[model samples]
Target: MSSYRIIGLFALLGGLTACERPTPPLAAGQEPAYDLTSYLQEQTARLQQEQPPVLKSVITKGQPTETLQLEELDWEKELAIFQEVDLSRPALRDFYREERHTLPNGSTVSIFTKDAEAAAPVDRLQLTVSPLQKLERLEAVVLEENLLFYSKRNISLTAEPGSGNLNGYRVEGVQKLIFGDSLRYRVDANL
Candidate 1:
């Protein structure tokens, strides 16, 4: 083959490989778990394609509540905090204790609590799945504390009952820094 042709072929192959999605790391001997990263990525793609209108409200300490109707949104930016609660990281494989229970309404709940000795930001994750195996809701609590600052966030996402589409989401949190006043805020959005 000609040198130029070979170089072009190599470049094409590299470009193709770069287009492929990277797989999340998994621990040895561990059963396949829900891929929160991929799930959120898919949701972001779907929302981008659908371009749904969102009703959003924001409240801050000592401030009046602000409401807005948004026709366009940066889904990934909005969900960045939720993505930080990913529990499937290889480092956190055995850090969380998992529990499953079935409710009388035929829904199943799975709870993952971070082990006390494990140094992780996500404190807890709770998921509710319907009888049909569709995700009904997801809730997560994240806490970070250090010598300089401390913050906690309670986040929740709800899916439409039958369609399993994202219906709404809420994030409420408080943050305090050394020598700074505490800040509290809440954000709610409906699609």
Candidate 2:
């Protein structure tokens, strides 16, 4: 092939391999902040002072995991990062909390818990969300060892491996975690 043709082919390959994302520039006068722990601590304090009722110190025991299907569903898109308060989205009309599970025998169960308990492995707690307006969803967990946040409808949960990497949620050594809307609880291992 001629030199020009060879150059054109290489250019085409380069274009095909490149990926581009249209992320917004950071605020002109602000630096990026990554100390999320401190930020959350501030929010916790504010909640305690301004709305003490919304903040609760809770510890729950899991009933039995033998019958409950502990699964997490995931749905996500590769988009620029944004917050629940960012841009315009549908307003959350009404919201409630519930625990829904499926048994090995294919039976489904739903219970509206007044509060999420830090319970044992048998129960996979969930927030029965009914947002008034549709918008992107999010989930965060504050486990005793480390805190994790995953974008909702994309993060999935799996059975606690006897041991595994952080590739997925493992229940071992996990005592306390916060999931969605300040919902706090613990995961017991014995089921």
Candidate 3:
């Protein structure tokens, strides 16, 4: 092969190889302000420590119209329901790709995207941890591009993993999903 043709082939191969590599969350010489994964593990353990009262609410158009005391469901069943929507478990976290960023106020934001599952609508999860490793915010969203044309049942639960306080931690869960005929359900709980 001519030198130019050989160079072109090598360039094509390099591009293909680069596409196979997963991007790192941090830039060169940069470290995350908080240990998000470890913090999640700690939160999970704390939530499992005691059975806290769960306040369940249903909201429509950003306003709560219905409220229920979910103590009737019990903690074990409630946690099992939460695990179905929240993939904070380390084993399930393996399926997600993590990225971290440092905010101007010095807090760290860690995002985990489960892009591998094309069928699910809500796959992106984010957690904002304070400089002290305190979870301040948690969010999960459904990327519009990933929305299925037909109907999809996507449930997401949000919770603060572990708080650095004598009062211990709190567990909050949210379940949002679409069933048959495009019916949508939004359920939020604080335990």
Top candidate (lDDT)? 1
**lDDT to native, each model:** 0.86, 0.28, 0.53
Name the weakest run of 10 consecutive residues (lDDT summed) in model 1. 24-33
Using TM-score as the measure, the top candidate is 1
**Clash pairs for candidate 1:** none
List, residue by residue over 13-117, the lDDT tens digit for candidate 2: 888768533344444753222222332344334434443221112233453333233232111210111121111111111111334444464433333222244
lDDT, candidate 3, at 163: 53
Q: Model 3, 168-189: lDDT tens per residue?
A: 2223333333342333455566
lDDT of 1 at 2: 100
Show where candidate 1 strays beyond 4 Å.
1-32
Winner on lDDT (2 vs 3): 3
- Work out the TM-score per prediction: 0.80, 0.20, 0.47
Q: How badly does each model clash, as a count of residue pairs? A: 0, 14, 0
Candidate ranking (lDDT, best to worst): 1, 3, 2
Q: What TM-score does prediction 2 earn? A: 0.20
- Candidate 3: global Cα-lDDT? 0.53
- Give the lDDT of residue 144 in candidate 1: 98
Residue 105 deviation, candidate 1, in Å? 3.6
